[model samples]
Target: MGRMDDRSVIVTGAGRGIGRAIAERLAAEGAAVAVTDVDEDTATGTAAEIGGKAVGIHADVTDPGSVRAMVQRAREEFGRIDGLVNNAGWDKIGPFVDSDPADWDRIIRINLYGVLHTSQAVVPVMIAQGGGTVVNIASDAARVGSSGEAVYSAAKGGVISFTKTLAREVARHGINANCVCPGPTDTPLFSSLFEGNDRLRDALVKAIPFRRLARPDDLAATVAFFASPDATYLTGQTVSVSGGLSMV
Candidate 1:
């Protein structure tokens, strides 16, 4: 049996990239996974690809109603939610001084408020069920700050703080909340940010002690650990999977 045998997990933005990797890992570890995404096709497609006790639900993380519906759907399919991975996020690259407030609003909505919406809808279920684990995907940018990602960093920093506070409040209910911060990951989002800028990508790779960008699986493994029985005693903590790029 896998580490997550018989557990049920909901992973947001699970159509591609890191989210997809997390879903795949959880499913492989014997967890029934709810793979949610804004795009219905991609969500269902990913669920089909994972091929197990996995279901896909379309959910807009930025919307409370949508998040609630997604949670309801997961509960209907899996009977109970034993884990939640808030992995949905978006970002745009530009100097903070040059960034538009609208963009900042969008970033905050997806990266920070999304976490709030999901946790609010799902935590009560966990409490009712006696226990659950929350693995929030924050960012190394939030911990160390990154150029051209000021607003994203601020939003993710709020996630880290919110997660810690949630952990404290929900520990009495047997809920564990923690944050995972990934750095310079090799995903479509990362590629989009550095399109035609190979020099910057190369420089970043050289800067990391690992001499490479973090694979989605790297982040996935850590998230799985958080969701598994291995992390029952861990809560209100933030882990950085940055290949030694940020050591704080």
Candidate 2:
């Protein structure tokens, strides 16, 4: 049997990139997943490819109403919620000094507020079910600040702190909360951040001890571990999956 057999999970931002990889990995381990995304078509497409035991639902994590509906759909489809992966995030790579106030709001909304909305929507379900797992996809920038990602780093840092506090509050209820920090992974978002800047891309590659960017699968494995029975006793912890990029 797979590690997550018969479990039902909701993975936000599963339309593509690291989110998609997490969903696919969990499904392979026998978990029925609700692939939620702000983009309806992309979410549905991801669910379709996964075949039976998966469904795509529109969820805008920045909107509480949308998040609530998304959770409701997952419960209705799967009968119970066993795992929640908060993987939706966005960032604008540029010096903070040159950033607009609007940019900060966008980063905070998608990166920090998104996590809050999803967890608020899903945590109660897990508590009522007697137990569940929550995995928040943070960034290595949270642990060690990144040059061009000041606001993004701050938002993710908030997620890390929030996870710890929530974990303590929910431990008695058998719900686990944790954060996974991914380093410079080779994803669309990452590419877009450094697009048309070969020098920056090459510099990032050189910084990593492995000399190669992290594959989506590299991150999926860590998230899977957090959502599995193997991590039942592990909570309030932050694990980094950056291919030796940031070691603390």
Backbone clash count for every predicted candidate, in the order shown: 0, 0
TM-score of each: 0.99, 0.99
- Structural RMSD, model 1: 0.5
User: lDDT (0-100) at residue 21 of candidate 1?
Assistant: 99
What shift in Å separates residue 40 of candidate 1 from its native position after superposition? 1.1
**TM match of model 1 to true structure:** 0.99
Which pairs in model 2 have colliding backbones? none
For model 1, residues 1-248, the per-residue Cα lDDT tens digits are 99999999999999999999999999999999999999989999999999999999999999999999999999999999999999999999999999999999999999999999999999999999999999999999999999999999999999999999999999999899999999999999999999999999999999999999999999999999999999999999999999999999
lDDT by candidate, in order shown:
0.97, 0.96
> Which model scores highest in lDDT?
1
